[model samples]
Target: MNVNKNLLNFLKSQPTSYFAGFNRGIEKEALRIHASGKLATSQHPKGLGSALTHDYITTDYAESLVEFITPVEQNAQTSIQQLLDLHKFAYQNQGEELLWPMSMPCFVGSEDDIEIAKYGTSNIGKMKTLYRQGLKNRYGSYMQAISGVHFNFSFPDSFWQAWASSQGKVANQSSIDEGYLAILRNLKRNLWLLAYLFGASPALCSSFLNGKSTPYPMQKIGKGTLYLPYATALRLSDLGYTNKAQAALNIRYNQLDDYIAGLRHAIRMPSADFASISAKPGDYQQLNQNVLQIENEYYSPVRPKRVTESGEKPTDALERAGIQYIELRALDIDPFNPAGMSVEQVRFLDLLITWCALTDSPDIEREDESIIAENLQQVILYGRKPDLLLEKNSKPIALTQWSTQILAELDDLAKIFDGDTQGVYHQALMAQQAKIENPDLTPSGKIMSHLLEHNLDNGSFGLQLAKQYRNESFERDFHHFTQTQLEQESKDSELRQQSIENADELDFDTFLTQYFGSSLSD
Candidate 1:
């Protein structure tokens, strides 16, 4: 695979300067489990701070499923260290409750056992809860309890400006937005590569199947474990967070305006399926009868985002100000890492995303969109299969052959980053290559081996890992933030939530109308 000459030249021109200031934030979700390895039914721990307003810690779908968010940082090491600090803080406050270590839940009893996360009396709080309620109604609570990690990333303005200048274009928001969208489109087309290399959730508890029949041949490993021998990242598959309604959505990432329009249309168009459920404020099963209650409900492998102002919806923020960052939502929690992710993984992402941005990307046609989806589904379900093939440019290509080509390109990009440092980027590239050569080296492969070696089900293996992580978290020192700082942030977040609740002036209906109203700037 020949490297893009223009991209290489541009990087070579700024050997020490490129990608030095890129920003990144991490959001890691984990289900809280009891000492007995059952899902915890307890409310959000008070010591963790307000779920509605906490900047660092909050509940994702269930009250027992905690999401630890880190502030944006310029370096991967710093961002990862901050996340570790958050885990340490959460472990301290969680008492006997342990954070489930894997992407899949430990031991769920019944659908009703998963408690919806609660916010206080604020209308906004109620709205958040209702959204989760809708998800539970649409997709089961078991699926919602499946936790993962989100990586939010953005190139620095200086880097964008330089790239625009090289392309004989002005370094403005429009150009930057276009560049980001192109990267996103290319990322979508090649996301299967990421899944093949990093996908971790190969096997899950049989409870996850929920008595529904699946087409895949599932072998029972232990008491209740169901798995495909070569499957990788089942969490990214339909078995994870999925919606039948979203499968019909033909959203495209080739253009920013079209992307926003697609989301806006989904939120406004009423869904016959969701319409059956009541939308009355207190009786609301969902936020509304629309295909999407809010823009956030649209599940995608990637999303372009801008930090929103007070009372501004996500779409409104993106329209008012162009894209500020991109969020990669397909990453599964690495059961091997107590922090749910590794700095090496973050470094690999930086290289891949940067490559996406620099490479020339053609606009995806409507027909090709289906191909992209198909390719992704193939990798998610059967990526590690020895003889698996994937469609690239509407032609069949062996998965290994395609992956090998992409990795070779990444190897070139990594050298640019490994300029003076300790070859971190190159090492990450080689590590990924090793996974392609040896399937057992992948996280999902390791998980399967662990299950077979221990003679345990997926749930049992995950529970033991959770216990191990909990012990490790308790013993780890605070790397980035102090306990005092975390405690203060908790208090401050609670106060902030109180202020929002006190300032509520509109009825719930009015607030929803304004939020979903026709106020999109562009």
Candidate 2:
């Protein structure tokens, strides 16, 4: 429905080789749980490396929540293989702990039990933990405990050059920024489809409710398992990782300058909600009382990101260069997959991302913004519900009907990326189309079916998969990395952390001042 005819025509003429340089990476986070499925109390494994300076593995939100990052690669299979090898290494080093297979965490006891991630004694490291402290105080730790996957995708200079040429535009940083921003907008518009197809979190351990009430109608399966029969990714729902506070900021996404300015305002805007909860750095509850302590605190399903230099804020890096890649933060870790995602999923993402960038995207109007948001919320909470109607063009339409239309365009893209060969891209597209055709084939639907058939709670089901995947991971030999190589990297990381700690010239209070020095003071 949203196609830039000129660019689409241009891409059709160019050989598929022009798009061969597309790069990808994966960063997946999962909680470290014991065999009993309770959150692991152990610190991040010494064998995994320093959370502050490590290239691949790190901690997210909590000490038990481990994040695995794969270096950028051109081939989708290579990136997936790297992710698996990283998992294998982690299994080898993490002792008896198993990575929680689901995005939604269960059996996490009190908020006190969930320790904020420690990044060591470096000034920047302390700042990282304190920012999380702010998140804990503001949104609570349970929200932070939720785990998911981030797919980082970027196109090459040649691909962008071709697009700019077709549009009579120069392929400069500004154009590159616009290209990525367009993908961001369109991705948001279609992200619900992702939640519908790949969302595996249909149910969660009732412990996740924390005895709180939920707006969505839910049913109990086992004694403590709560679920919505039609739900997709509850992690995308309000009860999970919703960004209720950031809604007020109204961050603009149409242009880079406006996006940066919006972030600038949020970082500086004093929040009374946070002010009441926080103490100073020496006895700190949070880094500051601002709306966002740092740009990374702001959440979006899709974000145009740059790899920042040391000590540079994300906005500073963006302003200095341009968007390096777009990170898709919408994915829920598939419980069935050993590595949390499959090659087919990423290949489909390649097709979708390219289509989004090439599609004509205008500035989102206020009403359009609401429609896009509604689509996501509806899909996450009630996607598999038969005859579900989603708002589109300010009117109600069947979810499947719209999905079918989108898939048609994606099929065309698969052909473009695959040429005459029967390739993985087309296969990925077909796989998703099957999900659209058969609701039961969707990850969430399958999860629900297994829960019903086996009479298992979310915790029991998750533990089963976690154990199975752990066994499979151990059996999977490393192709990209070795035990010795990973051990050496971890040791080297410790040295790097020490150097950073030794280089600290100022106390954390002064460090915070300089870090926020460029922002407008409230």
- Tell me, by TM-score, which candidate is best: 2
Question: Once superposed on the true structure, which residue ranges of model 2 sit more than 4 Å away at CA?
Answer: 520-522
Query: Mind giving the per-residue lDDT tens digits that candidate 2 earns over 1-522?
Result: 557777777778879786667899899998999999899989999889898888899999999999999998887778888888888888988899998989999788889989989999888998889888888889989989999999999988877887787678998888888888988988988989999999988898877888999887889998799998899999988988878888778886799999999999998888888879755756888777888888888888888899999899999999999899999999999887888999999989988998898788888766677788888988998899999999877689999999999889988888888885668888998999999988899999999999999888999888998899889987888888777888888999999999999988997788888888969484
Tens digit per residue, CA lDDT, model 1, 89-170: 9889988998888887776878899999999888889889989999888777888998999999998787787778767889
| lDDT of residue 390 for candidate 1 | 92
**Model 2 local distance difference test score:** 0.88
TM-score of each prediction? 0.96, 0.98
Q: Local distance difference test, per candidate?
A: 0.85, 0.88
Deviating ranges (above 4 Å) for candidate 1: 1-4, 420-422, 519-522
Cα deviation in Å at residue 243, candidate 1? 2.1
lDDT of 1: 0.85
Q: Cα deviation in Å at residue 265, candidate 2?
A: 0.1
